[model samples]
Target: MSKDDLKEAEALGRDLMWILGLIMHSGPEDRQRIALAYNQAQELVASIPKDNGDARPRIVACFERSDTYKAADDVACAGWLLTGMQERVNERDLPDWRKLRKIINNTVKMLTPPKPTIH
Candidate 1:
């Protein structure tokens, strides 16, 4: 990949991290944004050139969403690491930054589910 491609990938990584941040947040707005970012990140991850090893399967396994405790742990750990790295990339304001940020912010807002109000 050229320097530009590498930079683009890093920017995507940052957006992915922000999405993770949205996922963990209980806020309504951020929740939607997170969901959008999460989907986008998944798509981006899918697009990366496939290399040797079982990393792809393993990453997909994390998203499998099974009832098993081990499965949950795998997903959590892998997702956390990827998301964290993505955030670092996002901080740099690399290419494709605007669209990435906008989508993540919007998705986080959309992801919020209804909650009971305190009387």
Candidate 2:
């Protein structure tokens, strides 16, 4: 990624962290603010370039997965994921494209709730 791209990604990561923090601490009464921040974070995530390899996909996947539930745990998971993304960007050593995609696909299995079984 170019220097500008890196900077932008870093900024987005920071923004996401802040938004997630807000969501975690705010109560249900703040639903409107939470929703707005969530959408803004989604837009920020989408603005990240695909050329960044694992960075974008990993963030996107984790963010999407987090959106699956209204629970605090999922929000915390997203915060953790964003922290890792920021670290990778700061280190300038994102995972390879192929590996990151594989990881993202596998995350669905790991994070998804078990399907109900009908007798």
Candidate 3:
């Protein structure tokens, strides 16, 4: 979203403002999280669990050749990569970056509906 480092940082701030707003207003039933799925992909790079060898299958399982989500393969990895990156960056003593990640996770949580209470 940026033409250069400075522009990228500014653009990221602007984008974060909008994202934060959406998260606050979006109820769990909303599909708004899908819009930011690509950005969320950064999580995966750090999320390759030591026991989960060959993660491709897990990634591939989410993609489907369908009319509604033809681009799922590309966007589905956002959350995974974002989470992975967050872990790695935090390990490097970056508290501020971790704050941004908390916001992202909150957004995801907001997009998820509360489990039904068995009546």
Candidate 4:
């Protein structure tokens, strides 16, 4: 991936971590919202094309992390996955790194729920 794209993906990963932290500390009702958001994000991820062979190992690691996320009932899946994406970008010089980074970053965005508005 280009330097800019990698930076953006890193930023998204940080945001996902912060959001997951908030959800973890919040009440059950808020956690429910986050869970719903995660469900929606699964659909979004399914629609994204991420067929990068170079990043396969990282993707596999992320899948394992995702299993831990689900086991712990945590919304930290995006954070874990983003970390994998960032690593892939740093470790590989694949021609399609840009597309891969974009897909991963978009998944992070989809995993993030909109902030609740206060009246």
Candidate 5:
């Protein structure tokens, strides 16, 4: 991929991260905002160039089953996209990218519901 393609992917990753944050904080009663953010993220992912190997297709698949709001999956997909972008930019060790990846990991953890106790 070209430099411009990497940049565009990075921008989309950042935007999707923000939208995922919004979705995390939104309540079931706030379906409108959640739906909007979901759609926006989907569009952003779709806008990513197809030359980035299979990352774009994989990320897009994360949003295909729309019945449930899988925040953890969505956040993980965004992180995966960013990871691909970082690799393409050849800056995996950059402090900024590290920090972003950390945040994405934490967000995914927080969004994941606890497992049943099986008492």
Candidate 6:
């Protein structure tokens, strides 16, 4: 990858981190904006070249894992799980990171409000 590619990836990483922070904190009323940001981050990751290296894939996986947990009904538990996963990543424990990602992703399913039907 060229210098520009690396730079773009770094920027995307920052944006994704910020979006994740927002999503974890935002209320249900703010779902639309959070979802939009989430989609944009996914697009950014998708636009990066796959052959660049494993970095892109790893980063994408992190986001994908977090996404899986976004559906979790227990907000507190999901928040704690996310925090622990973040810590594992910070410690560079690849094995734990991978495992936590799967656990978090598989555990949560966002609770969506019901839509109104015509009478």
- Lowest-sum lDDT 10-residue window in model 1: 61-70
The list of candidate 2 runs beyond 4 A from truth reads 36-119
Winner of 1 and 6 under TM-score: 6
Instruction: For each candidate, give its TM-score against the true structure.
Output: 0.32, 0.32, 0.38, 0.36, 0.36, 0.37
lDDT winner between 4 and 5, please give it: 4
Per-residue lDDT over 1-119 for candidate 6, one digit per residue giving the tens place of the 0 to 100 score: 46764564454345435545655566885555434443544455556555544444535454565556565542232333333334334433343345445443432223233478899
- Point out the worst 10-residue segment of candidate 3 by lDDT: 59-68
Query: Distance from true position, residue 27, model 6, in Å?
Result: 2.3
Cα-based lDDT for every prediction? 0.47, 0.47, 0.43, 0.56, 0.47, 0.45
Instruction: Note each model's CA RMSD in angstroms.
Output: 11.4, 10.4, 8.3, 12.4, 9.2, 12.1
**Model 1 lDDT per residue over 21-97, tens place:** 63565454544444444555556555554356334443343334222322543233323334334343345445665
Q: How many residue pairs clash in each candidate?
A: 16, 0, 17, 0, 0, 4
Between candidates 1 and 4, name the one with more favorable TM-score.
Answer: 4
Compared with the true structure, the alpha-carbon lDDT of candidate 3 equals 0.43
Error of 3 at 35 (Å): 7.1
- What shift in Å separates residue 10 of candidate 1 from its native position after superposition? 7.3
Kindly state the number of residue pairs that clash in model 1: 16
Model 1, position 26, has a per-residue lDDT of: 43
In model 1, what lDDT does residue 96 have? 61
| Candidate 2 local lDDT, 1-119, one digit each (tens) | 56866565555545554545555565654534334444545466666665545565645554564555336544444433443344344434543434443443343233333579999
- Range of the 10 consecutive residues with the lowest summed lDDT in candidate 2: 104-113
Q: For residues 2-100, could you state the per-residue lDDT of candidate 5 as single tens digits?
A: 676557556746764764665467564443434444445546656675554644453544444332344454433333343334333333433355555
Q: What would you estimate as the lDDT of candidate 1?
A: 0.47
**Candidate 4 local accuracy as lDDT?**
0.56
**After superposition on all CA atoms, how large is the RMSD of candidate 6?**
12.1
